[model samples]
Target: MKKKLLVFLLIGVLVFSMAGCGNNAEKPKSDIKVAMVTDEGGVHDQSFNQSAWEGLKKAEKDFGIKVSYVESQQDADFAPNFETLLDAGNDLIWGIGYKLSDALLDAATNNPDQLYAIVDFSYGDKTPDNVVGVVFKAEQSSFLVGYIAGKMTETNKVGFVGGTAGDVIWGFDYGFQAGVQYAAKELGKEIEILNQYAESFSDVSKGKAIATQMYQQGADIIFHASGDTGNGVIEAAKEQDKWAIGVDRDQNYLAPDNVLTSAMKRVDVGVYNVVKDLVEDNFPGGQTVVYGLEEGAVGIAPTSDKHVPKEILEEVKELEKKIIDGEIEVPYNEETFKEFMKTL
Candidate 1:
């Protein structure tokens, strides 16, 4: 009887240990998997792609979702990158930037039931039900930056640079011009404004060339809507002993002394919001999600040790308050741009 009882206890221990191992294995299988497709700008461009990646990472932490990504080497590869992630069994796929719009539209059409979200682009009329278009009201923030640059420039001349002249990016350039115009008109000052586009988003040399020319022409402060190319802007600013404003991210850290401020696009917030909705089964589809000053989606970064003037800072703060209160409206699109110009 003693031998039989000892054998029985050993069998119980083995069974209990196996059951514990089974539970541990099952726990990992329950994790949700999310994935992303980056634009040709690539992940480390330190701009839009980087911001989107940061947001997706946040979702992974908040919801315990498994995250993965594929970088697109060029515009031609956008669709392939999207499809590759989808084929890998990603629960939802994110497409970063407007350059991926055509590819996303094509992929959404083919996959019909596939879940995806896009940042910075949209289908004007017929958006896919499974795709969410995340966009931002950059004009609102650009206006504030323009105000600061116009007010702070010692030369009374400011310039704007863009990666390309597309309607999407040009929106930032025009809005910036409007903002500078507004500050100039309101303050009863004649600030010379120069604007140029490099037509290439990744060419640092070209960006630097354009910025140097603008600076030589009397622009003491320059704001750029360029991507990695904007790195060139900072480089040029430092070389020339002038100041440049950054964009999309806190690029002030990139050039501490030369960077005055940055026009933020808040891409990370958009990414986090979309993924959160997806996890909660509240994915907003067939709609354009707009992030603006009111949503805290766009703003100017704080003045660095570069130490912007107190008066300029105060004026910008007041204008920001007015914008948030709906007392001052910023414009989007080309047609409304004319009206925005009148206000400036």
Candidate 2:
């Protein structure tokens, strides 16, 4: 009788333990794999691709999920990289640049049920139900940095170096110039703003040459929206003892003294938030998600204090708030910018 009772108790304990284990099962997202196909500049560009990878890494750490990426060496590699990540069973795949728009459309169309994301490109009403577009209001942040350059430039001349000619880069270009124009009017200084486009995001030498020429042309500070090409801009700034404004990331570490400030685009935060939304089963498919100053997705780098004065930093903060509050409207393209120029 005693032995039977002991055996019954043991069985009861085992049943309870099994029930608890079942109740404590992990969420489905734990097993979901995520991957990205980098742009031509690759993950080491220290800008777009790099920030996206950093976001995935943070997602892996926070969610206990696997994350990976495939770097494309050229335009031809884009389609193949997408295929590889998709074949590897990635539950969510991201295309990291506007250049991947065509490839993303094709891939999303072929795999109608497959979940996909693209940064910097939006398909509008034609977007597939399984795809999401992550875009940023880069103009807002560029304007802040441009204001900073306008405040700091002692030479009364500034410049902009760009990688490509597109609506996206246009925002960076016009916003910066508008800010400079605003500051010039305020300070009663006739500031000359120079501009250049290397037509390639990866050509470091061309970027350096542009910066050097701008510096020689009496422009003491220059802002760049070029990816890795901007690295050369910073290098030239350091060598020439001038200032260069970085893009997409806090590039102060590259040249602590020469880097005046960076137009911080939080690509990492954007990617991570999208991953979290997908894991929570709230993936916003067929939508163009715009991250802007209001979303805390873009701003001047925190390292700006290393060079920018307190007064200018405070003004930048106020300007960002005004923009978010609908008081200060930053222009995005040629038409809007022409109008904004009139106001400044």
Candidate 3:
């Protein structure tokens, strides 16, 4: 009996050791130490910053690599925050927003040996050899949610609120407009769409103010591409019992009943892909990779089923397939939108 008991104990210890071998927290699985620097919205904004962090965390878990991040309280903190991360000897550093374009560029230029990746910003021809830019087709996701709003709105008046008037935000702006146009045209009726820009991404109060004005103007459904500021739009929707669409991440949890759905941009995938490639020594540096609908980089939140109808979801899938199949080209800006509208 004693001999058998000792053998069982040994077997249990061997099994446990084997199971925990790769994930032994005391011993990192990879030599790559990764880090991230958040935008002014910080790491907890539950949007781009948060999504990017989730991706890095996932990479750290899968590869047993060390990951860390520093939040920027304001625009002035961008350069210094990046400097702090770079000084920490991180093998890879990620910047969470386009607001870090200049600082990231300067860092990459100054330290050509250091590797870097920026989410939501494409450096175009100015891309550095040591850096990679990860961008998404945000317009594709925004248009689907807009279609939902157009079909569901009983008032026939919808609204759009933007964080800033840049090329990035314009994708959300014009895509939503085009979607609403498409739906209204198909319905053989006119749907009034209102638009506004907060000019800042951090001001929640300003977002609320703009959304309140839109709601008072008889618009029932409002979609926002504002970062942290969009929280205010959701709040206004809850207060007025209207519908507000979220962005970047699934924000339905912020106001379950009030938020119709969210346009989910897979920022995590972009962050993870870069880290994974680096770990495998197949790093795609000095390149701009675009993740769009076909790549599963952008789509509506799964939680949409809670509010959006099945037929509408099916319609979204069909339209999404068309977009992915190249049968439908979703516009990214005003000029393209004008040309696209002429085709319809």
Candidate 4:
């Protein structure tokens, strides 16, 4: 009877120990799925789409959210890809370019329960309650880099190659031109800007052709906002031993010797913030969030070489402060650009 009692007590202790261990074990994390649909530039464009994807990847790491993406090969693919993501049970979906604005709106309308965010788009008063618009004051940063190109160029001729003539792309174009003009005036020099649009974000050959032509026309540095197409411009700059400025990402590594700097748009931050908000139940829908130099959403990448002088960088920083302080207004459209040109 004594031995039986001892065995029974041991069994009870074992059961209690197992119960305590079970109570102390970590609970399984709830699944929060987030997905993105890239624009025509796709994820590997090393530009806007790539930046958005980087933000999604970061969210997955930090928040333990399941993340996936669908690449849009053309304009027609946008809506379909959004559907694919929705069908796959994504709790939050993002469209990663201004081109996806309409598609995102349509999707948001049809799927009112799902949360959506779009980068580089402004819906103004038309924003849906289920959608969030993320835009950047790219012109503000483009101006700074344009100043860099203006001050660094020995030929007094700079060039801009753009992917499209849309409003968002035009922001980069107008801002850069304005910055160049501002720098030229400050330096007491006359500079001519050669600008053109390739009309497509993925046409590498066309971008290269445009850059080569500009360089041949005595342009010492070419700034391209042509997405993957800008990759071609970089190659042309390398081949001709000229300088190339990248857009949206720090492309110095693309051709470290030839790339002077890059006009950066913090798409990653925008995407990450929207996703974080959704995760935290504080999503700011039915609104447009504009990030600018003041918000550290746009700027120029660090110069990879000694081509840009320290004084020029310092001057650019001063200009950045002025813009952020509202002492200087960067042009973001054709009308504003024309007005800005008058000041120059």
**Best candidate, TM-score:** 2
lDDT by residue (1-344, candidate 1, tens digit) is 99999999999999999999987755342266788888666778778888889988888888888898898777888877887898898878888878878888888898888888888887756898988899988887888888888777888899988886776686687668777877888779899888888876787898899899999999999999888788898999999999999898888888888999888889999989987887776888887798988798898875533557777777887988988898777665567768876665
lDDT of 4 by residue, 150-252 (tens): 8889999999999989999999999999999998998899999999999999999999999999999999999999899999999999999999999999999
| Residue ranges of candidate 1 with Cα displaced over 4 Å | 1-30, 303-306
Please give the TM-score that candidate 1 achieves against the real structure: 0.88
What TM-score, over all chains together, does every model reach?
0.88, 0.92, 0.91, 0.90
All models: lDDT? Answer: 0.83, 0.91, 0.91, 0.90
lDDT string, candidate 2, 183-247, tens digits: 78889888899999989888899999999999999999999998988888998999999999999
TM-score winner between candidates 1 and 4? 4
- Give candidates' CA RMSD values in order: 5.3, 3.6, 7.1, 5.3
Candidate 3, residues 182-219: lDDT per residue as tens digits?
Answer: 89888988999999999878889999999999999999
RMSD (CA, Å), candidate 3 to true, equals 7.1
Model with the higher TM-score, candidate 1 or 2: 2
lDDT for residue 141 in candidate 2, whole number 0-100: 93
User: Ten-residue segment with the worst summed lDDT in candidate 3?
Assistant: 22-31
lDDT of 4: 0.90
Worst 10 residues of 4 by lDDT: 22-31
lDDT of 3 at 134: 95
